[model samples]
Target chain A: MVFLSFINNLINGVSLGSVYAIIALGYTMVYGIAKMLNFAHGDIIMVGAYVCFFMVSSFGLNPVFGILSAILVCTVLGILIEQLAYKPLRQANSLAVLITAIGVSYFLQNAAQLMWTSNPRIFPAIFGNGGLQLAGGQLMVPYKTLVTIGVCVIIMVGLILFTGKTRTGKAMRACSEDKEAAQLMGINVNRTISITFAIGSALAAVAGVLLCASYPKLIPTTGSMPGIKAFTAAVFGGIGSIPGAFLGGILLGVIEIFSSAYLSTELANAIVFLVLIVVLLVKPTGLLGKRTSEKV
Target chain B: MLKVEGINVYYDKIHAIKDVSFQVKEGEIVALIGANGAGKTTTLHTVTGLIRPKSGAITYFPEREANLYDLTKMPPHKMVEMGLAHVPEGRRIFLQMTVLENLEMGAFCKGKATKEDLDRVFARFPRLQERKKQVAGTLSGGEQQMLAMGRALMSHPKLLMLDEPSMGLSPILVEQIFDIIVELHRSGTTILLVEQNAEMALQIADRAYVLESGRVVMEGVGSELAASEEIRKAYLGG
Candidate 1:
């Protein structure tokens, strides 16, 4: 039983951890380029989940099809968010933009609540009847977990390839390092930033569809808890490091699941925060982050 | 192939460049020499579209346009697309990206850097090829400067504007950089260079302009400026 449960927790952790990773990519990429923390980022994910739900119920589409729809639509939403919410106030101080981001986040969350109501609408399942039983006290690993992990892996790999191998990816990296310099080099910084938001929100949309499929619930505020958790994972791994965000998310997810299972479920979220505080205390730059001393 | 006429630039009433004017031929390395805060950089920035002058005419080629471009009104990104490459005061490479990534960014204006272009850039800066996979921030200052130059070259610009490329470098690296600049000019790249090191700049430039207090104090051939009393007195540690 202990072995079985441990395996179950680990499997569950990977799936949940992936959600954090995908969501954190949105935060990390935007921060990398804009030097901004899009506080409204989580709500973007919630909006994605809601859109997926709408696609399925209103259009009688498969959750997988809904996932793609969510991704395409969220990409537009992400770009719009940048063009409208962030771009207009870019020249303003980070504090001003920060406040605006929070305003946007809250606005989206509350707006979704107003439109969708506080109730958690059921999401149609895509994994089919689950559970592959293993030896000894009969541990069962759900098929949904496998699918979730697969999707996260695929997206993560895709992201890494895009950033490492593509021209636009290189442009994004350039903008992140030095926006003024990137601009001077002929890269369209504004367009690159918009593209970044689009890609990031798309990742969040994928995460949303997965979450809805796995949990079978919907709410405008659903992305709230996971948003905070993913933020924690990002900080724990190293905020602007894309690969670091993924790694951090997985570790945090595993830590969270085991703590909940072996200890108290109520202590789960607290443990994640505690780890973040501890990591911050030990390494202010997070696990993979490097210390940057300001050069005049 | 470029000319500036009576250009005036300001930053909220703090006049930066006052009636500054200069010119460069189709294939020439023109040096702009000045002391700190002499508005040399401001003039360069204005030309590069980072700052626009309040009133001036910057005519390129045969000087046929009706009114000179309000460079100040143009964005930095547009400047590059127009075939101008500016290497800023600091070597601003993407620190998190690799050497390869930095070079790729430089070629962003051209869309895709052909294999021949990559090879040419690599040949010009072999050190970059050796450290293509290395992260930019880890590179030494001299290497970073080389990377900056290499990155600029990747844009395949008709005009290259460099600001204080020798600000901080060992004497050997400084000499090497000057040698490279001379070679770059010989290879037919038009250069607009600003330097505090008047002696080195004069030695490398075909012609030179001496700026003081936001105005052009003197202009002459490089060798002639190198021999002038004013150039010897203020710069060259005379």
Candidate 2:
């Protein structure tokens, strides 16, 4: 019985981790190229979830259409936010950018509240509420969990290939390393950054949909906790590394799940954060961060 | 052909370049020799559109184009598209990228690098070709300089501006780099060479300008300026 419960918790942890992984990828990529902590990224998730929720619930559209529209809306919103809010402050101090991001986050949250209200709406299931029975009904895997894990895997692979093979991807990498040098090489640095935001936001939409599907609760603040967790995952893995975010998210999710399942559910968040603090103390650069050395 | 007619640049309240002017004709190497703070790099930066001048008309006449372009109105990438390449100071090659990837970035304006472009760069620097897969940060100082030049050449630039190419290299390596510069000059590329090493720069230059405290104090033929007592006393350790 204990073994079966462990297996069940592990699957749940992985499913949750997959969602965090997808969100963390967005955080890491934006952080890598733009060199700013976009606190509003979390609010983008809220907006995306709301978009998906309205499409499916109000319009009675197919789940696929809802998901696609969510991604499209989020992508456009991401670019718009970057151009209006971030672009003007490109030359400003880092603290100014952070504050602006926070301001944007609040604006998005309040805007959602005005539109959708703070009453939590139960999210419709895109994947059917069903499960696969294994070990003679001793263990069961939900379709939602399986699909979430599969989608996350696919997204990760696709992202890796896109960045490794494409010209725009290489240019993005170049900008991340040195924007001035990249500009001199004829790479449009601004365009690359905008594209980064677009991609990050699109991924945020997918994560939002999945998160809402799994949790079955949608609200203005639905995305804040997950957004913060994913950001933590990014920092845990290595803030600017793609693979680092993935690893960090998975580990964080597993830790959170195990703490909740075995220990007190209320202490799960605190435990997760405590683990992060200890990890950071042991390795200041996080698990996979590169140690930068200045050349004289 | 390129012309800079009396450009003034300021870094905040400090005047960095004071009404500086110089010209590089087709198929010639023009050397700008100066001390650390004399603004040789700033002149190159201004020409490449990295820095905007407060007042001056910097113009470029392409080989086939009849009209002269106002370089001050263009961005640095646009300047590169117009066949000007600046091998910046300190060999700012992308450290995390491989040698081949850095060269590929140089050809970004061209969409994609043809096999010929790769061949040409590889022929010039065999070391880069051999170590093409290695990350750039792992390369030695001299190899990095060669990679920087090779990267610039990938753009097929009509005018190549090299800033302090011999910086942080051994004496023998400096000679080798100068030899490559002379070879490139011989192959019909206009060159603007900036260096603190006045002795080596003048040897391969067609015309030379001496800058002191952001002002061009002298301009003459390469060998003539090399022999001048003032230049030798100021730049060359006499």
Candidate 3:
């Protein structure tokens, strides 16, 4: 029974890992353009989940409509964060923005708790529970988990294509390389930065809705740890590298899920943090990061 | 035509440009010449809106008061929109973007670049067309210089101010670059050029301002300045 449970946990870990990867992409993309870790990003996700919960419970909206609402709201919130928090101090020290992000994160979390209450509100069912038969034995894989994994993959692919294929994508790449130069080219750099924030927040919203479906609870502070975890994924993948962020998030999720069964949950979180410390020491730029030498 | 007047600029506590003034008549090339610390760069920067002046007024003619802009105080992007484009020293191209992307970026002020405009730029610097898709940082020194000028041109400015366009090029490329400047001037683009190359600067500049320690010590027609004993011994090395 124990061996079967371990095998079952392994499958569950992969599905959960997909959700983390999807969320981490938001952190990675925003970080790539804005060049700062958005400490409030996870809260954006939490806000997303709450939006869905409110829509379904109060307005009796379809789950899909609620999901779309969550995305739209998160996108607006993300752009607002940039305009209000990031834009003014763009040329200031990175520390200023990092601190602002932390303040925003806390502010959003507290505001959320105040608005939605500190108590965990139940998330209405998006998928009923059932396990599919695997390897001749039934694995307790919820229908929600499969939907989450599928959604994450689709979003990831869409992001990759958008960033690589379009002219606007080319402009974004230009801005990331050098903001001053991009402006000289006549590109409305501010608009591009805002768009980047919008996309990143929308991705976080998707992850939030999926997470709510899996966990079935919503709280304002819910995005906090996941925020840190997604940031970790971004760093692990190579903070500035997009594909790296996605890979890092999925890897982190799997590690956390399996370790929870192998070791105590507290130990698991601690171990994950320890791994980050090690990765930082070993490769300061993370797994796929390119080295940028200082120019004279 | 562009005119500058009575502009005093300070960096921290040090005066960088003191009551310096000059002009570039239509289709003319004017050079701002000085030793390393002569505030030549600052003069260009002031005109380009990189740094604000401490005191004094700068007004253009005919529309002097009407087209009034404290050029030193405007934002960098806004300055470009006002028909003043600057090509900074050391060829500051977007290191991560391709050459084509860098060139395309120049036209951001213009609503979308036409192929003809790109062709004109490419005609001016054929090497840029060859490496349009290559990342800018990897370009050779001469290629980067061309790219820097090319980018400034993309904005279609009436007055193009360039700081040290030939700073680190081979003698051959420097001459080629000078030739291009003369060609550009002949084609009707007004230029405010700053340089340490005294000899070459005078050869093409219609007018010149010689600066020393942040103040203009000499100003005249390029031919007259080239013949001065002070310019001959100290700057022209004649």
Candidate 4:
């Protein structure tokens, strides 16, 4: 019975980690290209979840359509936010941009509260409830958990290929390295940044759906914990590195779940942060982060 | 062909370029020789649209085409698309990317470059082809310079502007860079080279301009300037 429960907890941990990984991808990509820490990135996931909820519950649409709608809405929203809020401030001081990002986060939360009301809304399962039985009834994992893991794996692989092979991907890497040089190479730096935001938001939509499906609750504030945790994962993995975000998210998720399962549940959040502090103390650049020598 | 009228540029409160003017005619190698902070880079940046001039009319006349462009109004990417390439100072090659990837980015405005195009660049710098898979940051200074030029060539620009292509290079590497520049010019590419090595630049250039601080101090035939006692004492370090 202990072994079965451990296995179940491990599955739960992986599912949660995958969601964080998805959200972390957005944060890392945006930070890598634009060189700005977007604090409001987490709220994008909340907006996506809310969009999905409305599509399913109010419009009586199929769950897949709801997911698609969420992605579309979130992508447009991300691009709009970048153009309207961030573009004007591109050449401004980093501190000013950071404060604006925090302001945007607050705006998103308040807007969601005003539009959807402060009450927590129950989320319907995309896939009907219950576990997929493996090795008969002794080992059962929720279909949602399996689906989440599978989706995460696919997205991660796709992202790897996209960054490595495509022309625009090369442009993105170039832009991240040096914006002026990338422009000299004939890349439209502003357009590239917009694309980065659009893709990041689309990934956030996937994370939002998976998160709401597992937790079964949605509120304006639903994004805060996951968003902060995902940002932590991004930092722990090496803030600008994509694979680092993946590894960090999974490890964080596993640690958080196992701690809650075996140790005191109250200490799980604290322990996760403790581990991060320890890792940072040892490696200031985080795992997989390349140490950059300051150019004079 | 490229032309620049009176242009002023400033960085914050500090005036950088003061009423700078020059022109690069078709099929000519024009050298802009200046000392450190003499505004050679500022001039190139202005032409590339990396830095917009405060007041100037910079015109680009495309060969075999009736249309002319006011480059001052355009952005860097558009300037590149209009067949102007600037190989910046310090190489500025994407350090984390592979050599081949760096070259691919050169052709970004062109949409797609054929295998023949790749081979043409490879033929010019065989070392780049050998180390195509190697990370660019690991390459030596000479290799990095070659990669920077090769990558710029990938765009097939009609006018190639190089900013201090010989900076920090060994004598042999500098000679090699000059040789490649001459070869590129021989093959019908209009060259606008900004160099601190006035001796070599004037030796190879068709026409030359001497800039002091931010102003154009001298303009004439390259060899005539190279023979001048004032030019020799100030720039050529005789």
Show how many residue pairs clash in every candidate, following the order shown.
3, 0, 6, 0
**Pairs of residues clashing in candidate 2:** none
Which portions of model 3 miss their true places by more than 4 Å?
Answer: A1-11, A127-143, A165-167, A293-296, B12-14, B58-74
Q: Candidate 2: misplaced stretches above 4 Å? A: A294-296
DockQ of each: 0.68, 0.66, 0.40, 0.64
Where is the poorest 10-residue window by lDDT in model 4 chain A? A287-296
State which docking tier applies to candidate 1: medium
Assess candidate 1 and give its lDDT: 0.85
Docking class of 4: medium
Over A144-210, each residue of candidate 3 has an lDDT whose tens digit, in order, gives 8788878878887888788765667767877787776565555567888999999999998998988
Estimate how well candidate 2 is docked, as a DockQ score.
0.66
Q: Cα deviation of A74 in candidate 4 (Å)? A: 0.4
Each prediction's TM-score against the native? 0.93, 0.98, 0.89, 0.98
Task: Provide the TM-score of the second chain in candidate 3.
Answer: 0.94
Please rank every candidate by TM-score, starting with the best: 4, 2, 1, 3
| Predicted candidate 1 versus true structure: per-residue lDDT over A110-223, tens digit per residue | 898898899988877666657677775387777777777887778778878988888988888788878889889888889998889988899888888777777777888888
Query: Which candidate comes out best when scored by lDDT?
Result: 4
Error of 2 at A86 (Å): 0.8
Interface RMSD after interface superposition, each candidate: 1.9, 1.4, 2.8, 2.2
| lDDT of each residue in B115-181, candidate 4, tens digit only | 8879999999999999999998889999999999999999888999999999999899999999999
TM-score of 2: 0.98
